[model samples]
Target: MGWPYLGETLQLYSQDPNIFFSAKQKRYGEIFKTHILGYPCVMLTSPEATRFVLVSHAQLFKPSYPKSKEKMIGPHALFFHQGNYHSQLRKLVQSSLNLNSLHKLIPDMEAIAISALDSWAGREVINTFHEMKKLSFDVGILSVFGLLDESHRENLKENYCIVDKGYNSFPTNIPGTTYHRALLARKRLKQIMSEIIYEREEKKIMEKDLLGYFLNFKDEKGRVLSKDQISDNIIGVLFAAQDTTASVLTWILKYLHNDQKLLEAVTAEQKAIYEANEGGRRPLTWAQTRNMPLTYRVILESLRMASVISFTFREAVVDVEYNGYLIPKGWKVMPLFRNIHHNPEFFSDPLDFDPSRFEVAPKPNTFMPFGNGAHACPGNELAKLEILVLIHHLVTKFRWEVVGSQSGIEYGPFPVPQHGLPARFWKESNHHYRH
Candidate 1:
């Protein structure tokens, strides 16, 4: 319906995507019909409409992804499941990653944070984006596949880079293309997972990592997940945890650097928590994540200002009408995350960075950095805790300042500091802050 079959696809890719969305919202208003990525789409930005599509009328829509991603993650991937299957997979994933059980993971999480920050201090300049991914990937590998040898874990991280690139690439299978390489990388990961699974089975060991749960648990059909399913879901978890969390962590660094006042306040909050524990350097606990209410507020505020995933896409399985507009069946229904996030109607002076706005909760469905409804991220708590732990350690132990002239953020899928957030970090030794 827009610009031939290409529709408004080029418009999206032409500039800062938020700029395009802002312009379109100014001209068309919210909930306008447009064509994107060769499909008819009805974009929803208001909280009511987002709630309608994501939760209220969710049954009328189904999750969809680009061909490149589907091929990369594979046909049996947990992401493709719906209804009961989706619920079952969600439970299995939650059993290990959810907040209620995260206490068991605090030791590993703290160790990862200390090691990463200590290493970063050795360098004259640390790139925020690269360092966050390394930490996030390390935590994911530790909690999800702790039994694997260090070499295999590094191999997994290496192939993950290729697979991630293909995620946003065009669906071309031609040799020398990123897509081809991504497919090849996926194959290598699968081979590694197969060998690991074989080794675990041969030893009759029932480990406690996410992979161990998948390797041993049976679904309602009374069947264990195949190695292919295990590998595909591992890909799902890794992809989910890696860049998204990294993006948040990178933004946290920039925010703290920009506001020394807020950093001091957050640091004081953590210092109390850190010194409160016996021996002063013990690992955090799951329940303790709630102790730093301000840190969580800053993280939430950052999410609102710049969401990692700009929109959530679903295909309408049936005609659905909202506020007198009809979204036809087979159309793509995209919930513009930022539109609602930055909406003046929902957030007063939405452009301002005010963590105190979250001093109280935003209206229901008004804030969903992690998305809402049935498809909400199961690992949301895990990601939050990881961020909290890292921020806690970094703030209490070191002081940082932005090193270069950053041009601000640019979106490649999600927003990132155009400069990669180069920063000079100093490890604190005095164990105290001066007012």
Candidate 2:
């Protein structure tokens, strides 16, 4: 088949991506053609194609999709910047997420996790997703900008929701539309970021938080970055770090709840670590978090199975050739990670929850939870720490069980619990551990 130009396909794809992507893979193999909102798209479904598009030839594939950029993240975000500007901003921002910094932040991360868990005591049924989202947001605020005010926290959360909902709606600045609301949210966010930057500059606060680092940062020529550049970079990091971690943790809880054996193993490992620590005097250290290899694998497995940001869309800068097929210039090319992640060729029993798949023998380029290459998520290290620490805390403190049906989780852009991840947790009676 050359290409399928069915209008209904776009509707179906937008409505339920899991079924649509699966049907395309079954019918069209590794590479397929489809249309979205009247634009042609080549959907790449194999690891080879994904590698080529995202890693090998990423320069030719830019992420500044007209709709996604103009509607979703706003034009001011670093996500839409290209060439030297993007490179410089990425470098400056990426420095904050470096391994050493992340290691230093582990105690803070664990303290936040423990605080969140402490608040949930005596509750029978709770939505883990909501709690994780709040906790993740708070951590991001504190670690990124040193935000501690309660009112500011609420405003940030509300603005994030507005912006997230703005992405899929029609692009317009007209009031009452989703896009318009998102624009307003963007404006509000930019104002808050500006105020923060100005205050940091005026007070000369030399703290080690990301905001302080950016404020004092200088370019190669000794020229300091502008306030707008700093604001955009901060917003970009905030957007990427907050929700992605929350989604991963939510899915991890779901998987652990469904699989008793895996949950028990993870819990046992956590207990052993706690027992060795003697007193709960020190928070969960970065060294200890990294030592939890099994916990890391579980988070990776959950991320692989739950394809967050399911497909990445890139417009062809110029005509490109792949397997003798011409991807014409300006055509939308979407690398479908869901298809690649679920493909039996790369993973055995692709649909099953098995962290051992990664433990026994990990596959490079085949498993991309954060993505790949130059554009690969810079906050990957921080995300890993956040997920691992959250799981470590949750598993050690309480035992969780699915409230009702224990069927495998459903897939959204983010793997969302169909029933709000309703789980029952009780304080662990073993009490054999200190931390």
Model 2, 323-365: lDDT tens per residue?
8889999888989887778887889898898998887765667
Error of 1 at 421 (Å): 1.0
Backbone clashes, each candidate: 0, 0
Model 2, runs deviating above 4 Å: 1-16, 66-72, 170-172, 406-412, 433-435
lDDT of all the models against the reference? 0.84, 0.76
**TM-score (all chains, Cα) for each model:** 0.96, 0.91
Best by lDDT: 1
TM-score attained by model 2: 0.91
Question: Cα-based RMSD of the predictions, in order?
Answer: 1.7, 2.9
